[model samples]
Target: MQIIIINGPNLNLLGKREPEVYGHQTFEDYFEQLKTTCSDVELHYFQSNHEGALIDKLHEVGFSYDGIVVNLAGYTHTSVALADAIAAIPAPVVEVHISNIHAREAFRHHTYTGAKCKGIISGLGLKGYEFAVKYLQEL
Candidate 1:
């Protein structure tokens, strides 16, 4: 299976951003661990701070990839275009959030992309991406 992990805005600071909420491990470290565990599958990762770049990437792989694990991050509450991009894609998208949206501020409680996803995994840390890969592998 080919899975693409699409992370957005400020996520590049994963290790240093917020140790309490996002943990101390960088996403790259966790991604390597994921690759080790899911050796049978092909995993790809992309991260960008730009909204249009993300949409472009979604459009690029959305149809060809087997599955997509996207953490739209701050865009989750703001980008309808991203939601539409996911909706337009054939790949099953599973939204992931390292921090629980429900447990945070009211503004973070809403997600424009969740409805467009096949499922959502929240507050599961980097492991959420691993779970998403596994879920897609089953298909």
Candidate 2:
């Protein structure tokens, strides 16, 4: 199956940004682990600090992908456009979060994308991506 993993905003700073919350692993390390776990699946990964770039890629590969796993970073609590793009896609989206938004700040509790996603995985750090991939494989 073809699975697309998309990350947004400050996720590029995974290892250095906030080690306590996001973990010590870099995004590259996380990607390698995902690749190892889902070796049989065709995984395509993309990350961007720009919201429009992520949205554009989502639209570009939406039809071709079997499933989408997104860690939308700060965009989860904001960005209706991102949510709209996910909703427009034919593939099932699983929203992943490194930290538990509900326990962090009141503003972080709301997710514009979660409502449209097939399911959500939060507060699990980088392992959430693997869980999402496994879930997609089961589906």
Q: For candidate 1, lDDT tens digit of each residue in 2-80?
A: 8999999999999999899999999899899999999999999999999999999999999899999999999999999
Report lDDT per candidate.
0.94, 0.91
Q: After superposition, how far is residue 7 of candidate 1 from its true place, in Å?
A: 0.3
Give per-residue lDDT, candidate 1, residue 75. 99
What would the TM-scores of all predictions be?
0.98, 0.97
Q: How accurate is candidate 2 locally (lDDT)?
A: 0.91
Q: Which stretches of candidate 1 lie over 4 Å from their true place?
A: none
Q: Which ten residues in a row are the worst by lDDT in model 2?
A: 28-37
Number of the predicted model whose TM-score against the real structure is largest? 1
